[model samples]
Target: MFASGLCFVGVTGIVRYLGTELPAVQSAFLRFAWGVVFLLPALIGVLRSGMPGLHLRLHLGRGVVHVAAVVCWFYAMARIPVAEVTAIGYLNPVLLTLGTVVFFGERLSLRRVLAIGVALTGALIVLRPGLREVTDGHIAQIFAAVFFAGSYLFAKRLSGIASAGQIVAMLSLVVTLALAPLAAWVWVPVSAEQIAWLAVVAACATGGHYCMSRAFAAAPIAVSQPVVFLQLIWAALLGWVAFGEAVDVFVLLGGAVIVGSVSYITWAEARQRRRVVMPEVL
Candidate 1:
């Protein structure tokens, strides 16, 4: 989890450094392309294994959502402070909880509902929508969170039928296919420095996802979820040291509240799982 957080922070630093010089779509494609290269060994395994049984349509659907989310994220990161982007990204879990209730027919307990509300309050504090005018980056971050949540829901479904390596391979392939045309259309000449940064971003992102997958496999979500809070700290430090961006008090406070809410939700889920599993023993 610590490694995952650090890798993610490094990726964010690279993205912020690149800024909007490259179109968001093109940057996303480049990042994913580099990610695919990093995962070439796994791809080779998938090929040798003759393709893992997977729902192609579902994978493609997830790919679309993920691509959109990545584009929005790039736009947001280019415009906002890295810490702010990281803080705002916490809203993805809130959105994911709502999505599960609405679309997956998952029962929402009062505790979970309260957690969602608290998390939203934290988001509002971070954005301060009415007090200060919201920037396009703020809106983009919110939309990115929503789409990321959608992608995660699809990923959860996919996990039931596919191995982690298979899912990662399919996502890379589908995203490549989906974004290749736009990437070509928006192709702008990039300097060697930009290429190097993009490569670093891709490598870090791949490592981040790899660590995340390993963490999830090692422990239940309840145990692993709290570790994600570390990312905000890493992001803040990276932003400050790398870009001289100051971390605001409100961002820190709101992020803490959001993290607390998510921790409660994780505990609730774990408790619920225990209830279900212990009944057979009883």
Candidate 2:
């Protein structure tokens, strides 16, 4: 998980360095297109083994939403400080909880409600709309979080029916295909240097997802999720040293609040699952 965080920081830093010289859609497309290269073995394995109960529609839907998320993420990273982008992204799990309740018939417990409220408050602190200028970057990242939440919800549904490798591979291919037209629409003359940097972005992102999957498979999410906060810290320091972006205490504070809220909710859910299973065992 720590490695995953570092890889994420690498991705963010490169995107920050790349700036908006390339269009967001084109940049995103290149990343995923390169991602497909790294993940080709997995894709081939799925092709050969053949998934018996594959949900093609769900994969396509997830790819569509994921394209939106990546485009927004790239757009925001180019325009905003890395730390701010990372901090705002912590809203994803909170939004995922809401999505689950609405789409999966999950009960919205009071604990969840309180957690969501606190998470939103944390977001407000980070944005502080009235206190500071909320740029298009901020709005773009928020929308990215929403789309990412939707993507995760799709993953949740697909998890029961698909292997993690299959899901990841399918997502890469589908997203690459979906992004093609959009990328072409706004495409500009990308230099070789830009392509190389985007290739780095792709490698880091793919490695990060792999590390995250291994971490989760090795330990419970409640144990691994907390380590994610380190990404915000790393992003802050990286932005400060690399880009000379000022480190905002409020961003760290708000990020902590959001991480704490999410962690508490995760713990609560884990405990609830144990309770349900204990009765069945008894």
Candidate 3:
């Protein structure tokens, strides 16, 4: 998970460096296009598997939702400080928790509800909308978090029936196809340098997903999720050193609060799962 965090931070840094030179849709499209190249083997497997009709539709739906999230994220990363974007992204797990309750009928305990409240408080601290001018970037990131949470809900549903590789490969293929029209509509000429950097983004993002999957397989979420908190710290340092962006204490503090809340929720969930399984073991 540490390696996964670093890889994601690298993606954030590269996207921020790219700035708004390319349209967000086009940039997002290219990143996944390049990612498709890296995931071709998995794609081939998915193709040969002859996925069920419903499953294919779910994959397409997830891809479309993910495109929204990625475009919003790219736009936010270009315009906002990396740390702020990273901090806002912590909202995904919070939203995801709520989504599972609503969509999957998961039991939402009082502790989880309180954690959700605290997470929202952390987001408010980071934004401080009335106090600071809330830019479009901030709004975009919030939308991104919501869309990402939705995408995760899709993934959670798909996970019961599909291999991780199939899900990743299908998302890359489907998102690239979905973004093609939007990207071409607003496409601007991208230099080779920009393409190279976007390729890096693809590599880092793909690598991060791979590392995160391995991390999950290796250990429980309670053990792995906390390590992801380092992503905010790394983003802050990268923004400061690479882009000369001033470190915002509020962003860091809010991010820490969110992470702590998320960690608590993850630990609680793991404990609950263990308890449920223990009776069977006995």
Best by TM-score: 3
Model 2, span 1-282: residue lDDT tens: 999999999999999999988999999999999989999988999878865545888898899999999999999999999999999999999999999999999999999999999999999989999999999999999999999999999999999999888899999999999999999999899899999999999999988988998999999898899999999999999999999999999999999999999999998899889888885544
- After superposition, candidate 2 runs with Cα above 4 Å error: 48-54, 279-282
Per-residue lDDT tens digits for candidate 1, residues 16-108, read 988889999888888888878878898888767764345777888999999999989999999999999999999998899899899889999
The number of residue pairs in model 1 that clash at the backbone is 0
Q: Between the candidate structures 1 and 2, which one is better when assessed by TM-score?
A: 2
RMSD of each: 2.0, 1.7, 1.3
**Worst-scoring 10-residue span by lDDT in model 3:** 273-282
What are the Cα lDDT values of the candidates? 0.88, 0.94, 0.94
In angstroms, give how far residue 147 of model 1 lies from its true place.
0.5
If the candidates were sorted by their TM-score against the true structure, best first, what order would they fall in?
Answer: 3, 2, 1
TM-score of 1: 0.93
